[model samples]
Target chain A: MLMMGAVGLAIARIRDLFAVSMLSGIFSLIGAAAYVVLDAVDVAFTEAAVGAGISTVLMLGTLALTTRKEKLGGGKSKSTTAFLVVAVTGAVLVYGTFDMPRYGDKIAAIHHHVVPRYIEKSGEEVGMPNIVTSVLASYRSFDTLGEVFVIFTAATGVLAILGRARRRREDEEADEGGSDTKGAAS
Target chain B: MMHRKVVLRVVSKFLIPPILLFALYVQFHGDFGPGGGFQAGVIFGSGFILYAILFGVETVKRVLPPWSTRLLLVVGVLTYGLTGVAGLILGGNYLDYNVLAHDPLHGQHYGILIVELGVGITVAASMITIFNVFAGQSGGD
Candidate 1:
């Protein structure tokens, strides 16, 4: 948790977008480690892969297309209100967590829910040893389908935006190869 | 360029295959492990992303063009939707795996496997597509 705070602080203070992105990735990786400590391995796996690996690469790609540093003193900043809002929200969130059940509280409200049924019957019903997989893929398959559709939609949106920009660039420059795209790394 | 990138290129080449192999293992073995389509897809996608970063976008694009990645993403979504439809056609409720096989237990297994596979396909394709498009642009927006 302290490591996460350190990374977040570093990211907040950094004016270089590249370093900020790197710090954010480190923050995510630490968060993933916390998930593992909490025994939420599946979530940890997703967090590490998506947050650390994929997000870092995507951020670098975005940086490749944009300026490396944050522009200072852009317009009249509303620092006071922003600070107030952030403080209030953070206070509220921290206060809310205080009321949550302690880790693995035996008689926690969440423990009394359908989790028991999922644990006991998932093996026989779904015939899977990993209850999380059976729960996610079979008992609640519709939800997974919805998640997939969401990703599909997001990709479509990105494609639509990029396609137009590429076309406009081509029209202006009429460069067939667009070889400049590979010029940096190569 | 090649001289400067020789170590990066050689190391990634050696690492990429195993990375992809682990992703497939996660995708197929989720029922017994702590990973699934979501995790596996990102891992798989990152392997390619690593290759693209070190080897240049053009080399990766030659194998996985933007248009094909788009089609793969669409196909992934369809596979999941159609699996649900299959459950309906088999006289069960939508997404009901009881009718997928003779044995209801095995049916659930098959249903989960195929559904996760659908998720894996779409997710991996989407990641690749987004990365290629974003990095493929020649200049800043």
Candidate 2:
């Protein structure tokens, strides 16, 4: 967490977009390490892969298309408003954590719920030793299906936007070809 | 593109196969271990992305074209949905693995395996597709 904070600070202070992107990737790697400490291996794996790896690559790609250096100053009022929003959100989140059960409490509301049943019966019912797999793949299969569809939609949306841009460029080239022929005839 | 780095090129060539092997291991071993379709898919996709970075997108495209990626995406989803449909056809609830095989335990095993494979395929294809599209756009290719 301290490492994440330092990386975040570095990212905020950096004016070079490329450096900021690299710092954010470092932040994600730190966050994934934190997740591993919390025993959420699956979430950690995803954070490492998607946040640190894929997102870093994507951000670098965007940086290549845009400027490497960030523009100086968006005005004091904008900064003040952003600070205010962050402060308020952070306060609300901290406040909300007060009502939560203490970490690793066996008798917590969540642990008393369907978790016990899942823990006890998943092996017999789903036949998977890894209860997480049984829960995610069988017990909550519909939700996983929905998640797959979401990914599919997102990929389709990206393809549509990028592919259309390429097609438009091709059309412009075709139009320019006609103009080139007319100029030669003249 | 790091094409000039001979060490990177050779090492990545050596690493890609093992990365892919680990992905398949995670995909199939989720029932017993700490991984599943999602992580496996990401690992698989990362291998391809690594290949693209080291070798160039043109070479990767030759190995796995855009059309095949699109097809795999559809096939993955279809495989998942059809597995559910198969459950229904066998006189069980939608997505219920009980009827997938004569024995309930074996059915659950089969069902989870098949659906996990589906998830892995879709995820890997989607990641590759998105990467290709983004790379192509930025490269203006």
List clash counts for every candidate, in order: 0, 0
Model 1, A1-186: lDDT tens digits are 899998888987788999999988899999999999989999998998999999888898888887888988644457667878999999999999999998788999987789999999998899999999999998888888888989999988998899677888767675545556557559
Best by TM-score: 2
For model 1, the stretches where C-alpha displacement exceeds 4 angstroms are A74-77, A172-186, B139-141
DockQ of each: 0.75, 0.82
Question: Where does candidate 2 stray beyond 4 Å?
Answer: A183-186, B1-3
Top lDDT hit: 2
TM-score of each: 0.92, 0.95
Q: What share of the true interface contacts does candidate 1 keep?
A: 0.91
> Candidate 1, clashing residue pairs?
none
The number of the candidate with the highest DockQ is: 2
Worst 10-residue lDDT window, candidate 2 chain A? A57-66
The global C-alpha lDDT for each of the candidates, from Candidate 1 onward, is 0.89, 0.90
- For candidate 2, report its TM-score: 0.95
Error of 2 at A144 (Å): 0.2
Cα RMSD for candidates in order: 5.7, 1.6
Residues B42-105, candidate 2: write the lDDT tens digits. 8999999989977878899999999999999999899899999999999999999989999999
